[model samples]
Target: MHRVLLWIKQDLRLDDHPALQAALDADRLLPVYVFDPELLQPGPLGCRRLGVHRARLLLESLAALDGELRQRGSALLVLQGSAERLIPSLAERLDMDEVLTLDEVAPEERAQLDAVRQRLGDIRLLLAPGNFLLRDDELPCPVDQLPTAFGPFRQLVEQRLPVFQPRPAPARLPALPDNAGAYFASLPSLSQLGLGEPLSVANSAFPFSGGEPAAQARLRDYLWLSQGVRQHQQTRNGMIGSEYSSKLSPWLASGCLSPRRVLAELRRHEAQYGRNDSTQALWQELLWRDFFRWTLLRHGGALFRAGGLKATARAPRQLDRRFQRWCQGRTGVPLVDANMRELAITGFMSNRGRQVVASYLVGELQQDWRHGAAWFEEHLLDYDPASNWGNWAYLAGIASDPRQRRLFNVLRQARQYDPDAAYVSLWLPELHGVPQHLRHTPFLLPHLQLDALGYPRLESIPENWRPYLPSAA
Candidate 1:
């Protein structure tokens, strides 16, 4: 009987998984997931790059996957090592004929795949596309010819082409080889992996469990029961709660849920509940997600660079003391500080919070944009390298847009999104007494009044609050 190995990375779900299906097509399959030590090491953010919450969620998800596989007379082999070393060694030991995996587009990820390919020279490496809606080569424009703006790109794709429907889940998986479980130890715990305890559910916006089933249920509830999807466009900028957005990014990033699954379910919801402008707006956001994935695939390492693929000049900035304050959420900017503190405590932040804090870091403090991006990489449960880097580049005016340095007006933003100061109050109790209009500008309050109000008093504004001024690092 032919032996095939299914290497699980980000694509963890059993439903609509092309790699898993391909492995089952063989006579006997060995399913494996390697916890790479490299990834667990501290990134530039000085934190365990994958925080405790996500690590715990991954363990739970893998356990669920293992349980499901066992019921089918198969098992998920959990290993901890560099995949480049583990996969080839396991293939040789098991005498597997081929390896099946989902395609990866990120430069670092592609390098890992290439290393595996080189090591397992004779073993067939079947790469099934799971990460993107459109294949890299299938775009209407050449990689170089793709539009720099999102509007034109979306318009072109929506009008000229159709997004492929997601594949159905395979009816059943093939049984594993008799000795598949012998090669690995038990899955590691959060503490074992050097990560802290799982986050307290009471404090988290994304309190739901991880796994395909949980993800699907959340989607259903959000779209149908809660009807949050109906007002997604309007309320998505919410700061204090979970209902503001779909909260699917964590699942999507972890591969517990597929984007296509979300799209299909969204279509079902629209059909049953009746379509509206809100649903279309939600759809637009999903398309944005797809666009970023496509951008990384086409641009390669340039997405990670300072100037991006187009090679624009980046504004030079110094990492100053104010940058440290921003990082620690002590900037005395209530809205910015609250958002940063929230992110520090919980691994998630609202889209509005993300933009505000990012802008404050790059624009207000004049810190290096990359530093903020790296911190988000470590802290965000939903951190996808492509989206995180792509967004930072955009905010820093280093990528895509000709209007570089897109900084938000903090006061204006506060009045518009958090007009009642409810979100600010939740995270910054000191700011609870601040009026709705002044909550975003606590520094503007007189020292005696600010002290009476219990808000931290800023000594003075940084000398470099000018628009488009490059921060000194």
Candidate 2:
């Protein structure tokens, strides 16, 4: 009998899963997920890699995966420890012929895979392509030779769009060995992981649960039911409500949803409704996601460095009370504070809000961008290493295109995106009594009124903000 130990990583779903498909060939298959305790500990940036929000989603995803596996005559074995040591030891004890898993691009994850490989000595360790939209062979050029900038890369890929044919979930997974029950362990709760349960926010943008079922349901709702994606380009920058965007990132990041699967459904939607700017916008986003992953593969640990791909770039490196204030949503800048507070409470923030706040931290506050990135790593339910670090570096002016530092004018962005200040009022209850016109510029309010509202006073206003401030303020 060909006994195979299937190790699950980021790709939690069985649908369109490459590693799970390869493992199906085994006569006796034991699928497992190794929950690394290190993720609960603080990293170099002094933030735990896995925070409450992500930990809760991860546990839910694991439970969902186990349910799906059990239906196919197998079950997921979640073990708490280092993958390198646990995987090898388990494989040797089980006398598995081989250990199989999906490959990864991030440096730390790659290192873990190597360590596991070394420990597996005589046993074969097979690696399948990771959970990404495009395969290496399908890339327009070698990853090393890919374009340095997103635009050029998008243009190059658009010239020859590869066809995506995602695999269906297997109807039957092989049964586990008779002794597998001894190794099975229960899933850990958020408290067990040393994280308090996050309070539910009625205004959460991503209110959906994590798993393949939820991911597929969302795809159907956005494309067929509500047809909200038809207006994606117009409403993508919206900061309020779940209808504003697809809200698929959390599942996408957790690998509960396959990028290829998303693309396939998107293509079908376009065929029936006819292509439009909105559909094209989502296509572009998937490409951007692919671009960042390729960039991470090419640059390795450099992507996470102080200078990113551009080592000589003059990136800010400072942290103080300003950083702490920014994190707690008390930056005294209404727009920045609202977005930060939303993220802290709901574990979700709009794309426009992210850029505006990140710009405020780097450009206005002049703090170290990595700290902000690390903070996102901890709180964001949709945090992906490549996209999170890459975008932060780009906005901080340390990534490939240093010339494109996303030093946005926060006041201008506030006026344009939150013109009515509804987003601001929703997140900042203290600003509710302020007039709509002056809500975003509370610093201009009289000393007594500002103090009464309990809002922090802006120490200094930028010259660019003068034009955007309300006349009444």
Candidate 3:
């Protein structure tokens, strides 16, 4: 009888899980998740790979996954310590004939796979498709041959869109191996993981819980019940509410929901509602996600380096007080601070707000882009290394079409996106007393008046911001 160990990495759910499907033929199966200490330890960039918010979500997800498996006569085996050490040892102790897992895209994750494989010895280490919309063979061109710019890449991929058919979850997973009861350990709490419980932010745009069930509910609500996707193009930039965007990213990043499943549902929605600009916009976002995944595959470790894909490129590497202020949302720029505070408090930010804050960090604060990226890795509920790092590199002008440096005029963007400064006031109550017209440009107020609000003062204002500042200020 064949014994198989299904290694569950970020791909948490069994629905449409390629690796789980591949392991079904085994007479005995065990699904295991190893919580690596490296994720909680600070990296070279001075930030832990996992933070309190994502950690809470991750624990909830693991519990939900366990419950699902239990219904199918199986249970998730939760372990701790180094994956390279634990996975191999578990396989041997269980006498697993082979170990199967989904493929990974990021350099660090790929390195982990290599380490685990080296330790597996004679046992086979099988890899299935990763959490992406397109399979390697289904891409328009080879990873190396794909366009460096998103525009050209999107164009090429759109030429022949593949029909996505996501598989359903197995009704009954194979029974667990004998003597495996000890391995189905209990999940840890946030405090036990050396992190405090994150406060519940009432104004958080992403108020949803973690797990496959929540992910599926979100997908259904977005595409069917509420049909909010119909206006995604118009409201996606809004920072206040959940209806603005699909909000499917956290689930996607954690593999609680399959990308192919999302695409298939999107196609069904489009077919029922008749394709519109909103649907097209969401489709483009998926394409961008895939583009970043493919980019990471092509570039490997370079995406996380100081210079990114451009070896000769000059990029900031300084960690100054300004970077700290930016992270704390005390930069005295209303829009930037509001967005940053929202992220710090809620562990989520609007898509539009991310661009604004990232540009400010790289262009205005002039801090190391990796520091900002690392901070996001710690905070964002939807942190995907490929999209997160790839985007930071793009904004820093060192990856994905180096010619584009996304520098935003903070004052201008504030007026355009948060004209009433509601988003600003929501996160930065200090600015609530400031007049709506002068809210975004509080720095223009006299030092005495500004000090009264307890808001930090901008050390310097860009010349370009003069045009966007209100005349009354």
lDDT of 3 by residue, 1-473 (tens): 89999999899898999999999899999999999867899998899899888888899899999999999999999998999999999999989999999999999899999999999999999999999888889888778899989999988888988998888999998999998987665798888888989998889999999999999999999999999999998999899988899999999999999989988999999988889999999999988898899989999888898775673157666788999999999998989899988888888999999999988887777788989999999999999999999888888874223465447888888889988988898998988888888888899899999999999999888999988988765
Off by over 4 Å in 1: 44-47, 201-203, 308-312, 398-405, 432-438, 445-456, 459-473
Error of 3 at 106 (Å): 0.9
Task: Output the lDDT of residue 102, model 2.
Answer: 90
In model 3, where is the ten-residue run with the lowest total lDDT?
A: 398-407
CA error at residue 179 for candidate 3, angstroms: 0.9
- Local accuracy of candidate 2 as per-residue lDDT tens digits, 1-473: 89999999888899999988888888999998999989989999999898888888899999999999999899999999999999999999999999999999889999999999999999999999997898999989888899988999988988998878899999999999988899877888888777878998998888888888888899999998999999999999999999899898999999999999999999999989999999999999988888888888888998788875563267778899999999999988889999999988878999999999888888888888899999999999999998998888777773224565547899999889988988999999999998888888889889999999889998999998898877755
Better of 1 and 3 by lDDT: 3
Counting only residues 3 or more apart in sequence or on different chains, how many pairs clash (N, Cα, C under 3 Å) in candidate 3?
0
Q: Itemize residue pairs with steric clashes in candidate 2.
A: none
- Looking at model 3, residue 320 earns an lDDT score of 86
Per-model TM-score, in order, reads: 0.91, 0.97, 0.97
Mind giving the per-residue lDDT tens digits that candidate 1 earns over 1-473?
Answer: 88999999998788778787667668888889998867778765455567666777788889877876777777789988799999999898888899999998789999999999999989888899857656656677776688877899888777765544676656567877776666756788777777758548465688877777788789888898998999887888887677888899988888988887788888888889988878988888887877877777778888776565453345335687787788788888777888888887877889988998887777666677777887888778888877888788777774224455456767567767877777787788777676665666778777798888766677656553333122221
Q: For every candidate structure, what is the RMSD over all alpha carbons to the true structure, in angstroms?
A: 4.3, 1.5, 1.6
Clashes of each: 8, 0, 0
